[model samples]
Target: SAGLYDEARRGWLYPMDVNPAGQNAFKKDAWNKYRIECIGSSIRTWLNGIPCTNLVDNLVSSGFIALQVHSIGKNDTPGKQIRWRNIRIQTSNVKPSKADNIFVVNMIPNDLSAQEKKEGFSLLWDGKTTNGWIGAYKDTFPAKGWNIANGELSVDKAAGGESTNGGDIVTVKEYGPFELKFDFKLTEGANSGVKYFVTLSEGNKGSAIGMEYQILDDLRHPDAKLGKDGNRTLGSLYDLIASKKIANSTRPIGEWNRGFIRVNKNNKIEYFLNGIKVTEFTRGTPEFNALVAASKYKDWKGFGMAPKGHILLQDHGDRVSFRSIKIKEL
Candidate 1:
C-alpha cells in the first residue's frame, strides 16, 4: 500500500504490481517515515529515504488526502493493526525529490512525459480532436462509425466487415523511421490495426494498404486464426510475422494495453505489447520479403518497403478504443 494511487481513477498509477524496494522498506515493529512528492506532472515516493515509486500523470491536479485501513482478508488474523503519525502537507516551496533512472509510469492519456518530450515525442492524436487525422481516401475525419470521448478515440461496431463503416483513418503526414506508442482496448471479438507505411494508393476500396500491427481478440476474433501461424494475432506484424508469446505481455480483453511500434532508422521494425518486445524484422530483407511473398500482400509490389508513408488506424467495423497516440522521429 506504500505507492502512488490515483483515487479518482481507482487504480495504482505507480508500483503497479509490486515494488520490492518499497516492500523491504516496511517494518512491522518499528515506525517508518513515508514520503510523497508531487509536482506538476511528476510524482515520486520514498520510504526511509529509499526510493519507491516514480510516476508521471496529470489526472488529479488537486485533491484531499485521507487514511484507510483495509478489512481483514480471508487469511488474516482478526485484529492486525496499522498506524500513521507526523502526517504533514506542504503547498508552497515544496522541493520535489530528484528523479533517478527508475522507470516512470505515465498514466495520463494522450499526453507525454517530460522525458518523452525531451526525447522528441509529440502527440499524434490529441485525445480530443481529429485535427491530425483524416479518413482514408477522404479529405476529412469520417462523419460516421467513430467516437471520441473520455480521452479515447474508438471505432464503432458496424457489420464487422473491414472498412464498411467509418472506414480507416490515416495520419495526414507520413513517417518512416519513428517510434509510435499507443494504448488500445478491444471489445470481445474486435478486429482493428495500427498500420505504418500506408500509402493510401491501392484504390481505397478498403482499409488503407500498409504494414499492419494487428489488434485482435485472439480468443474471440476469427482473424486471429485466419492467417498462418498466428501472424494475424494481437501485436503481430500482421501476415508477415507472428507475435511471440511473452509472459504477461498482454492484458485481458476490455482492459487497456500499451502498443508500441518502432521503425528504426535502418528500416528494422519491432512490435511491443505491454512493454514486451514480441516481434522484429528488418524491411526489404530477404527473410522479410520471403514472408511477404507468401502472405496476402504478395501481389503488392514493394509492400512495406516504402521510404515513408502515412500511419493508419483501421476501422475493421469493430469497437476498439485507442489513446495516448504519440510518436518520436528517430
Candidate 2:
C-alpha cells in the first residue's frame, strides 16, 4: 500500500500531493477509465489520462491483483458499495506509459528503476557490502558497531556516545553538486545523521566534521531541545537552519523514512524528509555565514564550503538502520 493511488484526490501518499482542481478533477456518477502500469519496480497510475502515481518499489516483486470494497463509516449506508466493469489485466507485452511530471517514490533498497538509471542515479551503498566506505579518520570500515544484513546497514546502540563505538563511516569517494537519497529507520529515542561535505580535515573530533541532516526522535531525544530554535531537530540542517514543520514531514519511530539532499552547482542545498522539502540554504552566503557564526561550529573556518567531500553515516551510538543509499551527480 506504499504507493497506492488515491483515486478521490488523484495522488499518492509518499509526499503530500497537490491537485489544483482538487476533487473537481474527478467525474462524479459516471464511469472513468483507470490505467495502471506495473513494470519491475515502477508503478504508475492514471485516471482518465491524468497521472496519479509514479512509484518505484521492490517490496512485493510479484502478487496477484484483487479488488475489494472499502469499509464504510457508521454514519454511511450499509449497502453502499463500489463496482467494477470491463475489468481487464494485461501480463504480456506490457510497457510503461509516457512519463509525467509527478515525483517518483523510490523505495527499493540499494536498487534503481530504469527511469532512475536513465536519470543518472547510482547506488551509493551496495546494501550488503562496505566496499566503498571506511571508518572516519581510518582506512577501513569499522570492525564493530555497524551491521549489514537483509539489505540494511545499521549502527548498534552504545551508551549514547557520539562516535565512541565504531565511530562514523564515510564514502571512499567524494561528490560535488549531487543529489543523495537514503532510507532510515530509527529506534525510540535514537539519534543519527546523514552528513554531506564531510572533509574529515578536522584532525580531532568525535564525529567527522560536516553539515548534517539531523536525525533524532524529536519527542524523546534531548538534543532536540538543546539546539537554538529547534535547529537540531530531526530533518533540520543540524545547528544551522530548522526544517520547516509541515504535513508528512516525518514518520513514526521504527518506520522507514526517506531522506533526500540535493546540492546545486551554485551552492544551494535542499533537505527533504519523507519526500517533503524541509530545509534549504545556500553555502558561502552572507546569511549562511552569519548563522554559522552563532552555532557551535563557529570556530571552524570555511565550514560546509567544501567543493567535494565524502558522505557520512554518523555513529551516534544508537540503533538506526539505513538503506537505499543512492546518489546522482548533478
Candidate 3:
C-alpha cells in the first residue's frame, strides 16, 4: 500500500509499481542532495544522509545515467515544480573508511556477486532481455501480454485466467540438479507459479506440465483452498506436498519475496520461502509416485520423473514481476 502509484512517493518496491512522489526522507518543501555510487560490482543509493538502496549487480558495467522529472497532471497544482542542484561527478575511487550508520536496503537485481561466481552461480534471467526464455507452447516469446523493463520481466494484467493470453514461458535449456533463486512481486489477487522440470514435449492444451512452486495470494486467491491440505498455497509443491508455513516468512502482497528451489545429485528436492526451507522430498520414489498418483497430475504420463527439463514461469493473467533470477548447477 505504501508504494501504490502516487508518483513514486511511496518509494519503489520493484521496477513496475513505485509510488515515488509523496513519501520522502527529506523535507517536503525543501532542498536535498542525493548520491548514487557504483563501486566495482556493488551499487548504493543515498537519500539525504540515509542509505536507501544497496546491492551487487553486474548487468550494468557502464552506461549513461539520466534524471527524470514527473509530468504535472491535470488534477495537480499549476505552479509546482521539481528541481535538482549541485550536480556533481566523481571518477576517482573513494575508499570507505567506515560503514554507514543507517539502514541499507539490499536490492540485488539480475546480478551475480563475486561470491556467486566463485560458487559457480550464473544469472538465468539477463535482466534486460528475454534471451533464455520462450513461450512454453510456442517457439518464440509471446508478442503481447508480457513486458521487460527496468530489469524486471513482468506479465501484464488481463482477463484473469491461466495460460489463456500471453501463455506460460519456459527456459530454452534443460537443467538437472541445480539451485535456482528469484525475487518475485505480485499484484493483489494474483496467481502465478515458478515451475521446474518442465518437459516441453507435453502437447497439452494448456501449460506444459511440471512440478510448480505455487505463487498465489493465499488470503485472496481461491486456489489456495482447492488443493489437498495446503499444498496449493504459496511456497508449496503445488497440489502434492504442502510447504511448512513459517511465521514472518512470506512478505505481504506487493512487496518483493524471495524463492529458492534446489535439486541435488541425490535427486533430493527442496523449496524455500525467503531463506527458510519449507519443503523437501526425493524424486522417483515410491512415495513420490504415490503422491503424484493421488494428485491432479495423475493423468500426466511420467510426471516428475524426468531427469531434466526446462524451468517455466506461468502467466496467470495477473501482474507479476521477477528479478535476480540466478541458478547454479549442483
What is the number of backbone collisions in each predicted candidate, taken in the order shown? 0, 0, 10
For candidate 2, the lDDT comes to 0.83
Query: What C-alpha lDDT do the candidate models reach, one value each?
Result: 0.83, 0.83, 0.77
Q: Which segments of candidate 2 are over 4 A away from where they belong? A: 1-13, 16-36, 46-53, 58-93, 98-103
Q: Per-residue alpha-carbon lDDT of model 2 for 123-232, expressed as tens digits?
A: 99998799899999999999999999999999999988999999999999999899898999999999999998988889866998999999999999999998799999
lDDT of 1 by residue, 1-330 (tens): 467654534344454333455668867688988888879978888888877777777766887787876566798877667778899999999886654544445677777777667767899999898999999999999999999999999999899998999999999999979989899999999999999989877884777789999999999988888879989999899987999986556778888887888899888888877655689899988999899999989989899988999999999999999999999888
* Per-residue lDDT over 195-259 for candidate 3, one digit per residue giving the tens place of the 0 to 100 score: 98898877897667999999989999889999799999999999999989877667878988878
- Candidate with the greatest TM-score versus the true structure: 2
Q: Which pairs of residues collide in model 2? A: none
Give the lDDT of residue 146 in candidate 1: 94
Give the runs in model 3 whose Cα sits over 4 Å from its true position: 1-106
TM-scores for the candidates: 0.75, 0.81, 0.70
